[model samples]
Target: MSKPLRALDEAALVLFSGGQDSATCLAWALARFGRVETLGFDYGQRHAVELDCRETLREGLRKQNPLWKERLGMDHTLALGALGDISETALTRNAEITMEKDGLPNTFVPGRNIIFLTFAAALAARRGIRHIVTGVCETDYSGYPDCRDDTIKAVQVALNLGMDSRYVLHTPLMWIDKAETWKLAEELGGPALVSLINQESHTCYLGDRGTMHPWGHGCGECPACALRRAGWEEYVAEKARA
Candidate 1:
């Protein structure tokens, strides 16, 4: 992400989930690309609050800057209820979130990212876009195999060859930690953007919007909440030091 942005003619579609990570990625795309469209998945996640939060985050992001307002494009949502119908994980089911003996969390929904990228690539092809942005990161994550950088690289190659499209999947947050992600939002759009994410984006696996934490709203115990909380705290601490 240290490199300069490509020309404005290069359009991008974002894999937006209306969660903190995805929202940040959306902002990243808007800041760099000329036309940015968002695509979300309704894979029957228990935390369906994210689906409801998408429009709010999108609207807020577009308004944060005039350029963002101009670049933000159409939004799309696909219903992948089959992924949930087959996924018995905590995210897709009402089961309690827990760690598996094999070191991966129960929240890991196999092939979810792959399916998302495949569908996103198809959508991008239809829209004549060449770049796709996603928020998947291994620096601060739940040990999902699909979120790894190598996995995304492999997926990108597979996508381009299978579809015969020269689509470049962008992963700006792949090497950055959560603390850096918070800083990235500020660097892209300042405090207003940070506030928008804190108030609009949904990340709790439990879908507990009723309970509000300093970082955001969540049960504060789930892995997602814990990671976000820790990151926010570290980011705030670094800001104070500066």
Candidate 2:
């Protein structure tokens, strides 16, 4: 008889936002942690359509992996922050979500990830979980100052200090580029990750769903689109070579 799969024996809270990276991280958490819970924030992002995808993904995931889903115990919440009103970032304000020519791109929602992680940390502490998982990748990412390794480390420290708890922030996608991220997903669980990312996850800020553009839908002209397209091209090329 085969032995039962070993559980990670650690509870984790995932800062899920229904994006491809976050969704991949979610899958990773389900596989790695004994118990996992997901949290979604509605900080008034311009791409509110992604929330719908989040709900759909959560339900589908539960259906597909009933045991894993039961163990994870998903919880979705909304926080009222004027992300679209006060922030000058493209993701929040009226500025176009284009490539970063100067420093961080206009879409760089100042303190957005920090806020999310902070909340996740607090929630984790309350639930007696020591691990917090996020999907912020420096590679193939928008030039968001908040998405860098340094920023994440700083936030980790701040969260620990603020809550007076020993919590570890896990960035499964930190060192990997998008092409490699796709590969990691496959390594973890083959087509499950690929299919979820392709059909369910939302990467487009413009919310374009008509095109199966491989890298998920965006304007196909923005910085996000370019990075995603490049990653998809690399993934396809590598697959063909293999």
Candidate 3:
């Protein structure tokens, strides 16, 4: 069994994407870590609008709490936009999202989590930060192999061996499904978190924020929307029963 969550009381760098999971992880880091920073990637996703949302949410979270302004340090949006030029995935291009023979979805960007975690580890090492937080959950992921716990552990070992430094990668949502994720958000920030997630965070693949679904706002057709909708329904039903 995986270990339970603990207050690490150390500086952390969160691999934030301005989505529900990342936002929740950021909130979790802020509550548990002594200091925190966020790193966002502009990998030229089809929904680059999420980048704008990241900045907006960062500011909004800061404004919501005085401690956030002081403890939430520099948030960086790195320019990996060149990934779009070289990669032709559904997330960065207009293409049909179908499953491959290998059982991975067309939306899966190969090595995305690996690249993100590598860069996060490097940045954290430079800043003397030991903990790197990410919201990669295998339980609710849409068949993204990179989001698996074993993949994360392999990358962690490779990073430590390559850099000769000890870095702890924190995956608070690894074992939890989406309903548990919603519960976690509420536990960390109460109803305000629910509002922020529903109103601000971007999870849609098509970049359609105008449409509303039971989960949140999205195109309502993508795999992401499907998982989110199911999770929200389950969470709400559980609450109603309680």
lDDT agreement of model 2 with the native: 0.77
Candidate 1 or 3, higher lDDT?
A: 1
Pairs of residues at least 3 apart in sequence or in different chains that clash in candidate 2: 90-106
Candidate closer to the true structure by TM-score (higher is better), 1 or 2: 1
Q: What would the TM-score be for candidate 3 when compared with the true structure?
A: 0.94
lDDT of 2 by residue, 1-242 (tens): 13323348878888888877888888788887788888998877777777778877777676667666777675758574765567777676556665566866677777788878877877787788888889998877876778888999998888778778788888888888888877877766677767777678877776666777767766687666677678778887998899
In terms of lDDT, the best-performing candidate is 1
Worst 10 residues of 2 by lDDT: 1-10
Stretches > 4 Å off in candidate 2: 1-7, 98-101
Using Cα atoms with residue i matched to residue i, what is each candidate's TM-score against the true structure? 0.98, 0.89, 0.94
Highest-scoring model, TM-score: 1
lDDT digits (tens) for residues 62-137 of candidate 3: 8777776678888887888766777778998999778888887788888888999999988898888989999998
Cα lDDT listed for each candidate: 0.92, 0.77, 0.86
Candidate 3: lDDT over CA atoms?
Answer: 0.86
Model 1: per-residue Cα lDDT over 197-235, one tens digit each: 998899999999998778999999999999999999999
